[model samples]
Target: MNSSESNENVKEASSIEAIEDEDPTVLESSTSETEVDAANTSSSATEGKVRKINTETFIAEIFDYKANPTKWVYKGSKPAIIDFYATWCGPCKRVAPIMDELAEKYKGQVNFYKIDTDQEKELSGSVFGIRSIPSILYIPLDGQPMMSTGLSAKDEYINQIEVNLLKK
Candidate 1:
């Protein structure tokens, strides 16, 4: 084997070792919504809110649908909230921080994600049928997503999530 070939082999071996050494409990620690829910239920029942979802998993796990014409398909164990907004929109800017706050507060219960309409134009406009800024979609595990437009209050979002998603 040549020098370059030996280097490639070493790189591959190191990559494999890294994957093998990864802590198995990391998934249970950060990704498991059920565990978070259980802890919230037993401890701080009222304050539990929105869970932050990993971006890659959000795309892979959640089903995609086109706007007006297409329907949402939810097949996950936990419910989710998908925020459709643009950077330039003023109201969207207002709601962004609230979304972030909820993401941390509800770290394990409900998965949350934001899709930039400006960046993901076809996705926000054509796919999700978002005609306005700050359109929030609440997707329960079994049912269709409930769509709400405009700048909603923090309590309103929490109430909808609790009643429709978490209560189930």
Candidate 2:
């Protein structure tokens, strides 16, 4: 990456870190930190589920990136997939069910999250540089995250999960 790109990445990293420092729940996918934690602890109660994420949780839970912005450092013990989407987007709607299914199918093997682009404009636009709806971010346990936009086939998503997230 060029200096400018690198600088942008640094800036994004710092911004996300700052968001975490500000309000932790601001990044939570649903309700608040407690609720999400509850869901995680008892994820079996809800099969094939996808959690919501914000700037704060994204940094703290997904990747403690602020701790080290220069490299890929995932925070969670399990792999995760972040869905960056807008509610009004048709393609996003199409991808929603697929995400839910994937979340359920992967369940204990992987953590699934959804980030509303409209609600999290800063993280979506500035931090993640999201320009479209249904931008999926695949985060492995030990590697840089990869982003894919638009609606993709279920099999494609499964491939990514198996290859990137599961590493199998």
The most accurate candidate by lDDT is 2
TM-score of 2: 0.71
lDDT of 1 by residue, 1-168 (tens): 333332221111110012121212111111212222221132233223433332234445566332223344554566778776665667878988898788777767777766665555555544554556677777777756666667767877777667666862
TM-score of each: 0.60, 0.71
lDDT of 2 at 137: 79
Candidate 1's TM-score reads: 0.60
| Predictions in order: lDDT | 0.54, 0.66
Query: Which regions of candidate 1 are displaced past 4 Å?
Result: 1-59, 64-71
Error of 1 at 4 (Å): 67
**How accurate locally is residue 41 in candidate 2, as Cα lDDT from 0 to 100?**
40
> Candidate 2 on 1-168: residue-level lDDT in tens?
233332221112222322112212122233222224222344356435788766777776665545766566777778888887765667878998999998878878988888877676777766666655567777778766777666778877887778667977
